[model samples]
Target: METVIITGGTGLVGTALTNQLLERGYKVIILTRQPEKGTNKAVSYARWDIEQQTLDISALQQADYIVHLAGANVGDKRWTTARKQEIIDSRTKSSELIFKALQTNPNKVKKVISASATGYYGITKDHPFTETDPPADDYLGTTSVAWEKSIAQVISLDKKLVIFRTGMVLSKDGGALKEFYKPLRFGFATILGSGDQYISWIHIQDLVRLYFNAIVNDRLEGIYNAVAPNPVTHKELVLAMAHAAKGRSYVTSYVPAFALKLALGEMSIEVLKSVNASSRKIQDTGFQFSYPTVQEAMEQLFK
Candidate 1:
């Protein structure tokens, strides 16, 4: 079995991906700030601190692959200048640390799979974005550009690199769906802006499977959008969540952009922005999505 090193092993996606990798018989190693906190019998933990720029290079010395998922939570706070810097630095610095570690060590690590986001496309209101689309010029776009570029340094070391531009992941435990549904538990779900903005989402299971696929499938390289085939409008997404939660089908009220801006600051734009991403590139590689539609994905999540 191949040994794989994964950063961000404590996150929602990381936790799910670690279990899946372990179940598939891969020797999983997790990089964490606190090694003692990671108690997975199937996973070996190593210490890494992004702020201090320290890593256990010995962990990568024999790993077959590295999955870079370490980053500060984007939606965790309002996007103040300081908070925005934290987001950008957390992503780029972590990727730089990983790349440098890999380069300094004469390791057998052959491939590196890093995390990006559909936020790379910025606030697109019209066209559905593909991996081939040029990155946007906004804050999220610039951050993703720098984040992805930081990983490109690993490619220079002759490591085959794959970047997963992820979408809003839907899971029963956590993620945007949980945040979206939490408000609905109070008997009302408010749609931001016009509610016509498209939301591209995927099941957590599908995303984990996609990461695993990137590990084994040598043909998978470059940037691939990790999203479902069918995208939903904000209105449809709220209704689907309500349907999933067995809530009454009430009218979806709009939260005006001005209010969202005042409330969430710069983060409000992310909440209100329209982004429809295409996952055809990854699906073309013979990888099947378990939840291709929002309705189906939400149903599975709610179940």
Candidate 2:
């Protein structure tokens, strides 16, 4: 069995990915900042500090493949200049550390799969963003592009590098679905801004499987959008979530755009930006999405 070392394996997606990797009979190695998190017997762990540029080289020595997923959560805090830099560095610097480790250490690592975001295409209200679209000039666009470029450097060493420009991931345990489901129980969910922003999303199951596909499918290279084909507006998304969660509905009211701007600061724009993303490129690779529609995806989650 091949060994796969996943950076940021303690995160929500990483936690799930670690399990899926183990079930497939591959030896799992996780690089984490926290020691207690590496307690899983089925998975091995190494410690790394991206800012300090410290890492345990032994993990890379044994890794056959590496899935780069470590990054600061964009939604966790207000996007001040320092916070923005933190977000960018957390991703790019962590990746640089891995690349440096690979270059300096004797390793058998063959391939690298890194997680990116649909934000690369910026806030597209009309045009359906595809992998071929140029990276936007906005903060997210530039940050994401930088993130991808950092990981893409590994390709120069003749190793396979695959980047997934992921969209909003819908999962019951955590992520956007959990936040959307929270307000549904209170009679009405808070719809962001005008509630017209197009949310290109994917079921967590499909996203996980896509990662597995990237690992095994030698044909898949470059950036592929990890999203459901049927992207929906904010209104439709919240309503669908409300219906799924106990058949309740959002009180036909939206949180004002200005109020959101005031509350969330610059982050509000990101929350409300319409992103019409595409998953066709990934689909063309013969990997079918298990949840192709929002309704089917949400129903399964809420059921």
Candidate 3:
């Protein structure tokens, strides 16, 4: 059986992808920071301390593909200077560690697929960002660029490389939806800022499916925006979820821009930034989204 090594194999995306791969009869190896807690016999685990920059070389040797999902959650904490450094290192440094393992060890690994973000385009008010556009000169863009560049070692080693610039992923379990759902469960929706900033979102199912496609479809290389083509303004997304909830006394209101700025400080730029990314490149590969629109995505999540 072909083995796939995934870094950060316990995060939201990693956990879901692990099940999908195992169900398909693929050997899934998780490169984790806490190997002692890994109990699933169906999958294997290798311990790696990113902070210490160490890895189990066998994890690199036994893989046909590498899915690099290891990254700090940018929204989990306020974007202090230290937190910013952690976000960049979690991605780039982990990538460097994987590359180092491959350098020192004899391995037959063929492909390296890494996670990236739509933040590569910076905070644009209008124009939808495409893969062909140049990187934005901002913190998010710089970090994403560095993260992507760190994987150059894979391509340099003559392996297939795929990098996906993902947008906000909507999952019923957790992530952006969880944050949005809490307020909605109380019969109200809190829209951020002017609430007109475009939100490029994809269902968690679609996002994971895209990763599957990247592994199986050799043609999908370089960078592709992993977002639903039907990007909506923030207000539209909030109301759509409220409608989907089918709950009593549903009310949608804007949380003033000043309040969000005050509360989030530097991190507020993420929520208030407009992101309109296109998924045309991925779709051209004959890929179809299970949830192409927010209403469809929300309906399924609520169901």
Q: Candidate 3's residue-wise lDDT over 1-303, tens digit each?
A: 899999878989999999999988899999988887997888999989888989888677889999999999999999999999999999999999888887778999888999999999976655788899888887898999999999877788788899999999898787887898898877888898999899999999999999999888878788899999899999999888888885456877789888998999988887898989989988898999989999999999888
Q: List the residue pairs that clash in candidate 1.
A: none
Model 1 spans with C-alpha error above 4 angstroms: 247-251
Segments in model 3 whose C-alpha atoms lie over 4 Å from true places: none
- Judged by whole-model lDDT over C-alpha atoms, candidate 3 comes out at 0.89
Error of 3 at 252 (Å): 1.2
Q: What is the lDDT of candidate 2?
A: 0.88
lDDT of 1 at 165: 92
CA-lDDT, candidates in order: 0.88, 0.88, 0.89
Model 3, residue 13: displacement in angstroms? 0.6
Off by over 4 Å in 2: none
RMSD of each: 1.4, 1.3, 1.2
Give model 3's TM-score versus the native structure.
Answer: 0.97
Using lDDT, give the best candidate's number: 3
Which TM-score value belongs to model 2?
0.97
Q: How would you encode candidate 1's per-residue C-alpha lDDT over 87-185 as one tens digit per residue?
A: 999999999899878777789998999999999996665678988889989899999999999999988899999999998988868777777776677
Q: Write the per-residue lDDT of candidate 2 for residues 1-303, one digit (tens) a residue.
A: 999999888888898899999999999989888856667988888888898998888878889999999999998899999999999999999999988888888888889999999988877756789899898898999999899988888988888999998999998888877877776767776788888899999998899998999889887788899999899999888888777776754465578999999999989888988999988888888888888988888799888
Pull out the clashing pairs in model 3: none
- Candidate 3 lDDT at 37 equals 90
